[model samples]
Target chain A: MSENSGSTSTNIFVAKLSSYIDLSIEEHQVIEELTQNSMAFDEGQDIIFESEKNSSAYLLQSGWAIRYKIVPDGGRQIISYLLPGDIFGFRESLFELSDDSVQALTPVIVHCIPAENIAEICDSHTNLSLAFTWARAREQAILTEHIVRLGRRNAYERLGHLLLELLHRLQLVEKAGNSDYFLPLTQEVLADTLGLSIVHVNRTLRKLRNDLMIELDPKTRRLRILDVDALSEATGYDQSFLDQNEKPSRSPQDAIGFEEK
Target chain B: MSENSGSTSTNIFVAKLSSYIDLSIEEHQVIEELTQNSMAFDEGQDIIFESEKNSSAYLLQSGWAIRYKIVPDGGRQIISYLLPGDIFGFRESLFELSDDSVQALTPVIVHCIPAENIAEICDSHTNLSLAFTWARAREQAILTEHIVRLGRRNAYERLGHLLLELLHRLQLVEKAGNSDYFLPLTQEVLADTLGLSIVHVNRTLRKLRNDLMIELDPKTRRLRILDVDALSEATGYDQSFLDQNEKPSRSPQDAIGFEEK
Candidate 1:
């Protein structure tokens, strides 16, 4: 397990799980051992392919990965991005065939946890099972937000909303600064995700730069959100979905009606 | 438990769970007890609200419901339409407050299973816990498909795609004909869901009707897919994601690439 020597104890998986429940020392040890035995992939590599039998769940220990589906006629749709600490192959665990393919967007380190290990862990540890469920719920929440962005927002709003999403997600791993983060995704990938053409993505990005809402340095693949307030205002972006406040009781005066509670 | 007189043995929740796992007689009895006492809501009633602490998960026993997020200054995004057998408020069980609001689209009967009851069932029963996890995983798969529709398809494709989705889902409960299903959603709801304006939605529906692809009777709110193969072909609709094919020993020759696994 020494392969991941530099970053096992303080991994993003722990940070993410800690958002849902307190981990025991043994659980942390399991996590460290789980991550230490990982495989490495280069940028643009295909880690898992669509329709493949997914016998293991891949944990993104570092770098970026994306889940995408290709059309019969050659078009492609990028569904979700796997950030550090993010887990993929969950759907495969539930069902049989893989519905989409996973690709590495940057040089990535991934720990492949076989299904038997998960069963053993989940069977023996109730807290870990609950944490896994919580993680899946969070993923569902994120996907719900993505659907709203794709189905309701315009181009500029979509771009800003995505940037805000990235910022908040990166914040969980303490990777984001006040306004900047290294985003390795290409404009092509962004276009695929945003349901826009590459040219349109370029133009919208230029508009954001012109309006001082964001600064994307193509050479360095660095994104600096110039005016966070303005970007948020432009898109009506909110971060409530990312909150993991799982406590149960609150005021009954939450007033369940047409208004959001 | 006498309130559930007619369909105690073959309830939707049990049926849905039985799709993924075998439920013993005791588990079935538990589900029947859980659903016997239910509350009814009229059409247009809010069942759960966003940000309100969710105390119980609601099981839709009859009619339709939707999960929607109301944007600032008034705009509603319909994220998911809940069918008769569908469950809501699972997010609340994992997290503290609701992330979006659930509203009844038609007169509905819902059974609220308190969190403690769920805890009791899941703690004592491993299979039930696994079935619960399976249900949530299916929801995630549905959301993944929705993201693809919103981000990759055009308005016509989106509408056709959604119709096909309903047809397949309704078929699960023996509520759909060869190519027809009762869809109670209005054009406004469809517009909101497809990320198109009301007028645009109307135009798109008219085109589909003209193309002899669909027949939507406004008065009856019944949708008939006159040409199922063509609609699926035109829209690239696939239903593999919704299948519960959990048998693991498939030929690993499922294609691999820059896609999802």
Candidate 2:
């Protein structure tokens, strides 16, 4: 598919990065140009494979994907979810190979930014550079949170915490409305992500429904938190970790060590 | 303590970075100068506090530390271990806050690099910039491995995998011998790190010993793996995630979008 200027594919990215740094009209146009060409992957397709040398970075334009790895016993562990506007396949910038693979959770579209372009783009556009750095840092923070959830929280808390996190992240890209989003994860997927059994995940979801904390419809694939505040409090989910409002005061030039013009 | 040009403290860092990219003698001296000044922290001291606005990054000069967060129920989860030659506290470069706290597991010494210095240094020295980027990516890889260990591995695999990881990391800095090191973690710390109960961790450690894969001296706090290959095979621990020998062939200038003079 081809995207024109101001298309939703590019707008979502601009909207997400805009939260970290203000971009000029020209900068927005540049981003749109970067995403003008697109690639598509069907559901259940491996966008990236383990041990592969991926020389380009990808921007997820639409749909969802998961970065995951399998253990010796063939148990899959999802490291993180890639929502719309998320960036992946960039880890090869330093490490020439990837140990974990990324698979599309749904039909997906992406924009490719060749590895060589990454350095040039960041050099010419300091604001976009900082925004990309912000995205990587944000991804790290999310992974750290996931570590905490897996290491400390119980099954109930893990499920609630993940749901709340997805809500906030999806909301950033305008993919979710008030406390609701079209969740595509099945119980088996949730079990793999949360390190729980499928039966346990189903039972926990039922408990959440019974407690009136969330409403999830399997057929519609819609998930809604009945009370965002209560679920957050119950799960000790702190959204501040994902906050993007507190931008550094320095100009992009100063931020990236360039003298202001 | 004051460090000279060739001190082990700085050499460890030089050694670690050299594995990623070769550094010129002048570049090595620059690193030495940057780490000349240092701060010390006692065991259990918080090097960084959650929610604190830390304006500097640190080079871990000596001793071990842990990045961790406390759950709402007061359960602690160790995010990742901060060993010598590690860099941290610089997330402030993008986001203005830190959500995870770092605590010294042993008496620690670290060299501080102010956040502002990071941008300036990276802009001025392209090689150093790439080295720092490599470090951050390596840390991310380590965290991903931790997630897989916690989410997919059993108690035996988790403990074995962690030990092998620590051994390899410590060896890179010369803190470990052929297959062993001074393990500073108590059973409680292991429990928090591995997401297991203290009793379970203790049992797993014993199983490893009984299986002729390792030896541990509680009094000396020394741990030695009798057969690194055997343990790695059993646990599916792949050390390639921590490998630093693969260097990109592109000039440092090209890697960071700079023209060669």
Candidate 3:
């Protein structure tokens, strides 16, 4: 375990969790104790292994990660991407054991919370229990939406939906900047996440760029949405799911600048 | 609308709701009034259209249903499935309006609970509120699992896992018999649910049958698991998730012949 070498301990992730429900000073002290010493992983590092006896949940302090599973016959599926402030591996540990694994997508910093302490916290605080329930429910909702995307949507729609979802979640943690967001994803990872071939993902991305809907700068890892409306129309993602309180700035017509497919 | 015929009024679906939380005589009277006349749909009938302004939630009195959305390119993705004693279309009324449609997958009888009445009930009973919260969380969990399935697993594994999931949910209502369960689904629907082509589904089903794992009697809509061990291995479904207590079963091996894939 290594200490996080940063000046900001009270970052957006911590701030967001506190907004949902307050923690007393003693509770904060416990949280510090739980995550006083944490680990950092470079890109593409596996944090949680499939069918492993994992007993800790992680709080994403910085960078990105993904939870996924590998199937027989050498196929890989990226279940979901975990952004800063997102909680991962909690649901899997709630029952029997983890059936999937978590991998770092970028140089990631994580605050590890022991499962036993989480259980104790839930027992003591009703609000914490409610928060845990909400967090799990939200995680499930994301999974459900992913099922829809994988099972039904086309590659173009899937990519568009994926971008919109990332943007929405990023906005929740105040990481999104205007229509542009930092997307530290490689084409290979995108293909794995969307269950498409790398060649296919590249072709589709070219198409999206040609349509003037989005711009991706691989070197800078910046994704700029030129037309949110066009993207939303293509993806069928209503920004209402982004945050219950924050209304979308641009209308569907103005956002994407393209006709709904 | 037609009245709940004969003793079906005392069905598990109706009884389970009241068991979780108290309903006053008036509340019970209201429930009776709401369900006194309800509608039944055969398999594959659309029960709730996407984005419709219906302010009623359907209670599953019998059979199964699926909530889903159709993509622009004629692809259908099933978001979640509703089993007997399950409720659907309630979140639309509770939160914002729904963005998805729901359809019956088997001959289903449903009692429509009005949104206004549900709100009144929630305001009156704290237990009902908690139960409602739990219900929503559970629904979200199902969706999350769907996401994981869609984002990660392969066609064969997805299909097997989906079948196992349906079987487990059906067992809760005692609708599953031995190794056989009624599955009124076509290859097209299965393809949509699993994010595969109908041809692929057919091929996968044949593979399972050839492996001496499962047999599907299409004419009778009956599915027979020939080898529970093989089936579980193919699906990677843990029987513990099916336990009603939300805890893994004590004797998981006896509960089901599940072997991780």
Best by DockQ: 2
Residue A188 lDDT in candidate 2: 96
Better of 1 and 2 by TM-score: 2
| Native-referenced Cα lDDT, model 1 | 0.79
Residue A5 C-alpha lDDT in model 3:
46
Residue pairs in clash, model 1: A100-B259, A100-B260, A100-B261, A101-B259, A101-B260, A102-B259, A246-B96
lDDT tens per residue, model 2, B116-186: 78887876676787777777788889999999998989999999999999999998778999998999999
Give the alpha carbon lDDT tens digit for every residue of A176-231 in model 1.
88789999988899999999999999999999999988888889988999888888
lDDT of 3 by residue, A162-257 (tens): 998898788778889878899988888899889888999999999999999999998898999899988999887665543332111112232222
Candidate 3 local lDDT, B73-178, one digit each (tens): 6668877788888877766553332467888887888888787787556545444444455466456445645665676677888888888878777765678976
Candidate 1: list runs displaced more than 4 Å.
A1-9, A246-261, B1-9, B247-261
TM-scores of the candidates, chain A only: 0.89, 0.91, 0.86
DockQ ranking, high to low? 2, 1, 3
TM-score of chain A of 1: 0.89
lDDT of each: 0.79, 0.84, 0.69
| Rank by lDDT (best first) | 2, 1, 3
In terms of TM-score, how similar is model 2 to the real structure? Answer: 0.93
Q: Fraction of true contacts kept, per model?
A: 0.59, 0.68, 0.41
lDDT measured at residue A175 in model 3 versus the true structure, 0 to 100: 88
Deviation of model 3 at B189, angstroms:
2.4
